[model samples]
Target chain A: MYIIGELINGMYRNVREALAERDASAIKTLARRQVEAGADALDVNCGPLSKDPVQDMRWLVEAIQSEVAVPLCLDSTKQAVIEEGLKACRGKAIINSTTADTDKLDAYLALALKHRASLIALTVDKKGVPQDKERRLELAAFILERAAGAGLDAAELYLDPVLLPVNVAQNQLEDILRVIGDFKLLTTPAVKSVVGLSNISQGSKNRSIINRTFLVMAQAAGLEAAILDPLDQELMRSLITGALILNKAIYCDSYIEAYLKSKLKS
Target chain B: MAEELKMITTWSQAVCEMRLGAGRQEGGSRKVTLTVGGEETLPFLFKEGALPHTPLIAVEIFDVPQDDEPEALRRDLRGISKDPVTWAKAMVEDIGADLVCVKLAGIHPDGANTSAGQAVNLVTKILGAVDRPLIVLGCGEAGRDNEVLPLVSEATKGERLLFGDAVQENYKTLTAACIADGHNIIAESPIDVNIAKQLNILISDLGMPLDRIIINPTIGALGYGLEYAYSIMERARNAALSGDRMLAMPFICFVGQESWRAKEAKVPASESPAWGDQRERGIMWEVVTAMSCLQAGADILTMRHPQAIKIVKSEIQELMKKAQS
Candidate 1:
């Protein structure tokens, strides 16, 4: 289970506040806690709300990397932020995403290949998020092909079959899983599947529980990387257990040990 | 040389892996851990594949009966009938039930007219009194069940509680709660294999693991339509063993609900002398119904009568031993 700690994102009130004040201490604390809790990577997201989004992303990448040895996942909608974050990161980072859009795909793939960074590809194109599995899988394949065309290894691509909120469309749950499972079959052994873990449980009460359950189920369906809040003990436990059960993490005797050593720093 | 039998179906892949026990140290506070969905082959076929864990048995504890129960049950349960907490405790402590399934009959509109908070309190009392894993059930009233399950789930977080009758229309709240609370859910559909499969798919889509789900394909009493339920369960097991991941979870049955509701178990001795002793007859009715379902594919049986539960437990032990050998 490759946990991309989602704590550095500017979504939460605390994180947004920290970003606004440029509180490096707050940012470092969040990053260290996620690493101690079990995140393999810290996802640094500087949203458009920031005055200098690229410079803020660069500052976040540098601060988080300085505090923790774990890799960084450069998360941003803007290509400039991605470029800055990638440059600030010490080692190879995961490009938070690219869509099936031709221009964005070309730009994101070029940056990822140049930086020798992995990429998270959303299964959506110019129109919007696909409503069916076939379309999502088609979009994912296109992204994979485009990445390959850019001279990036297939293994570097992580497909995100975007999860639709259940409140909006109740029937979309299975459709997303079908897309992931079929994508697993369609892609080569080198390719990996990932998802924004919290999206499935968004808008529903008890988001943590739903998010944890979705993580386990998605892991069982062959999702290797998950963009998630790694500081959550329950979520970390579920991910570690799911990984062990699925034979993804063979070293740990039990989920407890797996989590303690891999996710928990202490 | 012995005759060579040709195999009709060839399964080369592993169907379902046995679920590890989920409880307190594993983030759940329950004393006994639940191990579900460890079928290497399908529901039952010891010769074909591995069935690691024995199907769990849960004793039913209702809030209060709508009407007078059968004389046999009335005799044993008369003392605790007034209070659900005492009744649930009696089922666990006295009856030696493996699991206590607390049915919130009070939540049903025609019953106590209890609010969701009352249901939550009752479930909390049951959880506090008993150390065993719980299966909190509703009166099968959709509106009431949907209302109560979420409250119950929130109140008993990390207990690994199993909740039920999550139908298509109102599973969101309950399923979401189960996910949040680290509990399990029962996806109930009519006794049709296809409907069962579809419901499982729907719940799984919500991100509930296959192991956390228990499929209730509805149930039938012995003289009513046991064969239909049995056939459907068998088919479901077949589909699971054949690598259909959707139908892989353990099967749960409303044994007591179905058997007690049937005419054979409810009617008095005076009305049916040919049925033998009413106590013996009613016990036999529940026992037979549960046994038949277990043989077909039921992995969890919620039973009523103590005598019937004893018989079913012994039979399960025998089957488990036979499978082990």
Candidate 2:
């Protein structure tokens, strides 16, 4: 139920326009809404698409932190973007990524250690997103080893198994969940796990419905964090309810107060 | 009397565990949260073992004109039907609903030709007007949902919303937004047990928790293949309870959509004498679908029709009572 409000990213046309025009109002609106809605952290992704990702991510992070108290999940594939995002972050932030690839892992882990930022590790290596759970687990194990060598705490590491669309491979989903279930046995107990929420519903009709249902299932499989849009009420409610059932929260009693406050601010 | 009862053989459990509530002391807002797992003790085993949580019932509200709806139900929603916000508000205030499920049918590419921003604005308006938990449903169009959900996610941000109808294809953008924005997701598969399990697996592949996922095995109305869906969900739940981790998340059924779409719910009274009164039939249609889903292991049932909601809620109360006793 740790909602990471994803509105500040520059991927959408509106956000892109706002970022390009330096429209602080639009950016501020998104930031405030996400915080109010229920996002625990705001993921700031100033990808290469932005004019200056480093500077833009830094500015976006600062702007969001000023208005909302939620932590930031700094997202970028570039080492430079991770560095700048880390530098700009006010409190402890989450590095949006690192791959199992040795070279990439070396760089990203260094940055995470340097800034004491939590890391989102992708279970993919020199080969792109794996097609099966075995490969995913192999890569995840490799990444975990490298992370351990780098002296990163298990709790600070979040593993992303990489959800592939079912249309491509019917069994692809089964493989992925198997890996998640196996991760409990494979990795240390303290290690956290998460996923980029969009991958499973790729190319399907009724995408939102499919995405939300899968998110609930993933939560069942022990996924802790998700890279998703924090604004959808249906998705948010599912997250709240799902977290309560999992006993992830204090006493499973915060629904009414939290929901009301979210609406009031909105 | 001293003889030990033998354990009954059952299908292997395949349900997954889903977690809710992220970043509390770890740094976000919100004092408390909850998560439900997809696990089942043995599909519909109310008498045999513990059913940790009772199924939740959600009331459905649509953004489209219901000219086709029966006069009885329409009368109750006369003024509200004109506006989505009013209708949603009524679902909460007048209907005693647990969750408000707003279907953005008007924004589908095939329907209103609305833009993503328009859909976002409509959802925002509705959210602004209600305090209860919300479930935003997209028209079952993959491309259109991708177009609208991200914006909707951006618009709602952090309300801990549940967005849906995510299928095997076209889930990336919306799923990404849900993950980024900290919302829950619904993984919908065709009415097949394997397919349901597969979708859950794929979503978890992205590092999303099973607790954050809800499985929709695809619903069917009373006669239009209800038994098929029922059996499939039953099998899936049995698998979860039997220890299969993939199918463990709580189940959701689009009762309103499935039941309302049937000919029985839509056809006029004169046209089908065998069906009897259209209002009674329609309400029964929804109630029967909702009840069947509950029997098959539905954690949350999204329904239309006030009568249907009332009946299902009471039925759920009775079931809970029996279980507690």
Candidate 3:
């Protein structure tokens, strides 16, 4: 599993204070910790409170890149902010998202090709996140069609079904799971799939348990990546166990420890 | 024109490379060192992946002569020398074995009951007599191996000997000794796949890296459950190529020990006239067992008869050749 650490975002209290004070050291330390905790990449977000989203995105990308060699996932709604983050990245960066809208697809694809970065496109168009599996797959197919037209390698694209909170949209959870697997069939050597795992536990009493359970279920459905808190030991262990059950990883008595050590080497 | 379909499977991981016997520049006395493993594809599918090294043959020598040893093997041993040092030298010099495997069977409680000091003295003498890379294995009894392996491992510290037969139930002491003395270990698992993986993990957990370990999947003689052993080895190679890190180490098979123990190899010609000459049949048995192991991903083969070693070694050269495509 490609785990993008979600702890570096400014939405967290410590990250918010670090962004306010422009404490690059705090951002650097968080980046290193996540990488040590087995994150394949880190998600750099400026949060909703950033007065200067473009500048803050660039700063976060630079700070994290300086501390760890892992790629940064430039998380932002605005194309300009993500583009700024991409320019500062010393290595390939991930464009957090775009929608199925033709205009947005055109803009993001151009940025992705120009920077040679992977793009994560959500299965949501101008109408907003779909509540059913069929609509979500339709949006994913549309995004992929645009990518093909632009001559983008299907492997460079990650499709997120935009999962809603289980507390409010309990009926849509199963549909989202199906959507994740269907995205792979949309192409040969199927397109990768990812999810912002915290979205499922939003407004839940037992957030950790809900998030862990959903992550494993999505993994069984062949989700390729996740933006999650790598420091969550129980959640990380569950992810490792899920991969083992799927035969994606070798089983050992100390498999979790083995995975962690392998991360350090790579 | 009809469209042709081509399917190519890609592997994300390859078996880890392990070098046996360190040379003078690397702080050991051996004149030769062999590097094994590092195959990205299954054995000899060169069109798919690189096979960096050919499989090796290690002639097995016992510290003490076996009373029940078949006459075919006894004839071969009589031509050479039964003494450990002279036998190791003849195996390397005359027999042309790529490596020498000294089986310290005399140290077993049921056998001559030799002391650890005697085993260590014999290992050091053989290391001096033969400059080839060495593989030192203990008696099958875990209790005695646990006692004898540490002393022998410490005696040949920088020689980089491959000490083994460390099983799931008794690996802690041998693994620690190998680690402390800077030697490689052979992890023995019965025909079961899960136990093979588990033993490797247990050995590695004691601060021993996976690259310094080889898996002994415990094979059977040809026609004596060889197909079952073949399946396990093939499954292990498939798992390794499919990215199972713990199962990715190179395999070592004791072809001579298993093949010779079969009644078919030991019966006299007068007893079974239809079975043909006992010596030739026994040699062919070892050769056939060794050949099957090579195809099933054996990086190292331990054999007894000189004629069988020559046949298996020549066959390895033939199999290592890649197709023109």
Candidate 4:
């Protein structure tokens, strides 16, 4: 599993305070910790607290990278903010998302190609998050079509089924999983899939269990990457075990340690 | 809608590439060295991955002469059976062995019980006689091996020999000696996959670089648990290609040692004429066993009979030839 650490996002109090205060050390610590905790990349988001999202995105990207040299997922709803983050990134970056909306996808695909970055395309548009599998697959197909039209490499695109909170959208969870698997069949070299993992437990009790369970199920459905908390030891353990069960990892007596070492080497 | 179907699968990692011997330029006297592993896909799926090295054959010669023997082997090795140096020479110069494995069998408590000094002296002579790289193995007795291997490891210090049969219960002394003397060690495990990986880890934990170690996932002769051994090897190779570094080392199968021990290989035509010519049956037994091992991802095969070795070598050449696309 490709783990993109979500702890660096401004939704967390520490991250929000650090971004507001321009404290490089605080942001650097989170970046270093996430990588050590087996994160393949870090997600940098300058949440609602930022007065100047673009500059803060650049500063956060620069600060975190100066401490640890891992790829950053430039997370923001706006294309311009994501563009700024991409500029400050020294390594390949992942654009946290674009919607199925044709205009937005065209822009994101062009921007991704321009910077040689990966873009996460969510199965959402003006119609809002799909309540069923067909709509999600339709939106996913639309994004793939636009990406192909723009000459984007399918490998550089990640399709997310727009995971919704389980408490409110309980009936749609199964459809989301089927769509995740369905997206693979629509292209030659299938586009990769990822999810904002924590969204599964939003406003729910027993959040960690729900998130861990959902992550494993999604992994079985071929989710290749996920935006998640690597520091959550239980969730990370489940991810490692899930990969092992899927034969994506080899079993050793200390497989968890082996997984972490292999992750670090790559 | 009818659509074209495609099978798109790929492995993210390849087995670690390892070199067995060193030359004068690299501080060893051998004229040739063998490199193995580096398969990015399953055995012989040439279209999917690069198989940079072909499977190699090593002829096994013991430190002591064999008096009590199988007629099939004694008939072939009549004169050379009494001396290790001649045996090593014939294996490399005549039999065309890619490498030679010197089994210090006499050092075992049940055998001649040869002293460590005697074993080291025999190894040094074999090293001098053959220009090919050597694989030095200790007697099966752990206590004697512990006492003997380090001395031989020191005496042949820079030869870059592949030494082994280091098991789960005892690996430290040899691992340390190999590290000090700059030789590679073989980590052996029973048929269990977890134990095999654990042994690799234990050996690596003692500061031995993983690539320098080979895995000896123990095998049985054909018709005697060969399928089980094949399954274990398949699982290990698959795991290695799936990004498991600890299990990613190349495999070494003892085709001759196990194959010759089978009852079918030993029983003569006089006793079981229905089994056909004894020598031909024995050679075929070894060949079939080696081929199965190679198909199941064996990188190095330690075999005995020259006829069997000749057949397997040609078959390997045929398999290594990828079709032009």
Q: Is candidate 2 or candidate 4 better by DockQ?
A: 4
Instruction: Say which candidate scores most in DockQ.
Output: 4
What's the TM-score of chain B for every model shown? 0.91, 0.87, 0.96, 0.96
Superposed model 3: Cα runs more than 4 Å off: B1-6, B323-325
Model 1: residue B103 alpha-carbon error in angstroms? 1.0
Candidate 1: stretches off by over 4 Å? A1-266, B1-22, B42-44
Q: Total backbone clashes of model 4?
A: 0
Q: Least lDDT summed over 10 consecutive residues: which range in candidate 1 chain A?
A: A249-258
Candidate 1 lDDT over A1-266, as tens digits, reads 77888878787778788888889899999988888776788888875578889888888887787788887889888888888888888887899898899899999889888899999889888799898888888887788788878898988888888887767766888887666678877655647888888887788999999888877887777777888987788887777777657744322123354335323322
Candidate 1 chain B — worst ten consecutive residues by lDDT sum? B12-21
Task: Report the lDDT tens digits of candidate 4 across residue range A80-182.
Answer: 7998999999998999899988888888899999999999999999889888888888898888899998998999899988888999899999988888889
- lDDT tens per residue, model 3, A1-266: 99999998878889989998999999999999899998999999999889999899988888888889998899999888998999999997999999889999999999999999999999898797797889998888899899999988998999999878998899999999888888888999899999999999999898999999999999999999999999999999999989889976656677787667656754
Docking class of 3: acceptable
Every prediction: chain A TM-score: 0.93, 0.90, 0.98, 0.98
Cα lDDT tens digits, model 2, B1-325, are 1233356444434355444333346333333333454333653454455566666766777777755666656765677778888877777677766667888887777677777777788877876676655778888888777888888877777767788977877566767888888778898888877566666656656766656778888988998999999888876665456444566678889898789888888776888888788888888888988988887878788887877888899888877775565
Question: What local lDDT does model 1 show for residue B208?
Answer: 82
The residue-by-residue lDDT of candidate 3 on B105-191, one tens digit each, is: 999999999999999899888888888888999988988998899999998988788999899889999999999998999999889
| Per-prediction fnat | 0.00, 0.00, 0.19, 0.62
Return the TM-score for each candidate structure.
0.54, 0.51, 0.94, 0.90
